[model samples]
Target: MDWGSTPHSSTMYIWHLEGLKKMDLRLRAFLAPLLFCLGFIPLWGIDIQALVQEQVKSAGLADQLVSVTNQMLEGAIDTGKNYQQVKQLDKLYQETKNLKAILNPNKGASKPTGLGAVFKKAIEPPVDLDKALNLTNALQKEVKNANQDGLDYSKILSVLNQLENSLQTALDLKSQWLDTRKAN
Candidate 1:
């Protein structure tokens, strides 16, 4: 029953083993790069998140956004201005969040896929990079309308400046990411 007993069968068995060895080598060659990229995704997320946080803190929005919003809420302010501040702050926060979502999409939110996603994109329009910069374009006018004991329009402007810087950093990172993808 041993193939080695016959020269013809032994030769056939040797060829079969050689074929398997070649196939194993090819599979390893293909999987090495795939596995490396798979392992890289989580590391990329952490690094990108850290970079964003660092940029946000450096731009000065990390704490000021919250503190300014709190002070405006507690202090007495004109009703109309109060409402305006609320609206503007909400928009700023939402825009900031959306930018972050764009950066490392795999980490935070899951986007829709397939035909539904295409339809949504068609209706909503693509993300406007200029939108973040324009968020506080009217702050100078708001500052002129400020009064004491009301919303600190000057401080609001300052915090928004930080928001602008943070957004700019995000935009820059996104550009780099796009370039890398294109090159790859």
Candidate 2:
């Protein structure tokens, strides 16, 4: 015996397909925010600066580590002695490039050692204040070394701006974390 669809059953099946499609769309819409909250997407106070710094230090490229940190601090300041602007994507790109040693005082074979390799390392989150300070001091050394002839005032300014921006971002993160906690 053949089980065939009646006219009424065919119409019901078409409606069921349409309903499934609508349900699929609605399900996607509902999941968007849920996934975002679970960190699949960015939320308020997301700090890319911290992520950059973590990667820089983990690479242990030493020289690039310092340069990147300095640039982050400086970029923060340039953003209006404010922290949010420090993580500006353009500024981050410029500093990341500098940290990677793509732009350097030396040319070709003369380029600073380990600059490129540093970026290859995966970033690790800071474990303590001592580690953070060590990173800061190392960055200072790189600036001093790079400026033996005369400091690049422009570079200094940019770094200062980035630093300020990073600090602001950190503060913003803290505030948001607190707010979330309170709400919860």
Candidate 3:
């Protein structure tokens, strides 16, 4: 099949047809998976812009929690009246409840399991939710145990300091999360 010696003959035509067939098969093999992967992009891709916006909102909420905690500490320190102290404690409790709501919107819902849990954990920021909740609980307990005759301002101050510190830690976590998101 000396196709090179007979470039204008039927043998040359046959050789050219074989080369075209081989190239066509290689092209199809390379393109098929590429097309399949492209088709799945819409299914798996996350909206980075929306995620960044959510991070911003979370950071702002963390800041607000810190501010409300500071106000609670100031209210406890400046007022010696029992009724006023009770009122301030109630306000602080309400603010903590609000912060919890903002941080975990599905608080009462059953937690995800298996692969769903893994994915949820992967997306969540590295913050100690349990520590924050425990701090809030301690604050509530301290306020409830206060004496009506004369509130123990020192104990209340100590609990308030712990709550403030927990809130500050949350704020720091949010800030770090935002910074990481921006960098990526």
Best by TM-score: 1
Q: How close is candidate 2 to the true structure, as a TM-score?
A: 0.29
On TM-score, who's better, 1 or 2?
1
Ranking of predictions according to TM-score: 1, 3, 2
TM-score of predicted structure 1: 0.47
Each model's backbone clash number: 0, 23, 0
- lDDT for model 2: 0.47
lDDT of candidates 1 onward, in order:
0.58, 0.47, 0.59
Model 3 lDDT tens row, 40-111 = 776443443444444445445544555565565566567755665657666665765665564555456667
Model 1 Cα lDDT, one tens digit per residue, 1-184: 7777876997898899999999999999999999999998987675467545745453346345546655664453335455656666555445444444433234333467999777755765333445545544444344455443444456767776766666676667666666656844
Residue pairs in collision within model 1: none
Alpha carbon lDDT at 33, candidate 1: 99
**Residue-by-residue lDDT tens digits, candidate 2, 1-184:** 2225565777777889999999999999999889878884354435454544543433344344446556645654565543334444334445444544422223244233385545433332232323333443444454554422222335544553454344344445545556765744
TM-score of each: 0.47, 0.29, 0.34
Q: Candidate 3 — worst ten consecutive residues by lDDT sum?
A: 43-52
User: Which stretches in model 3 have alpha-carbon errors above 4 Å?
Assistant: 1-21, 45-56, 71-125, 129-184
- Candidate number achieving the greatest lDDT relative to the actual structure: 3
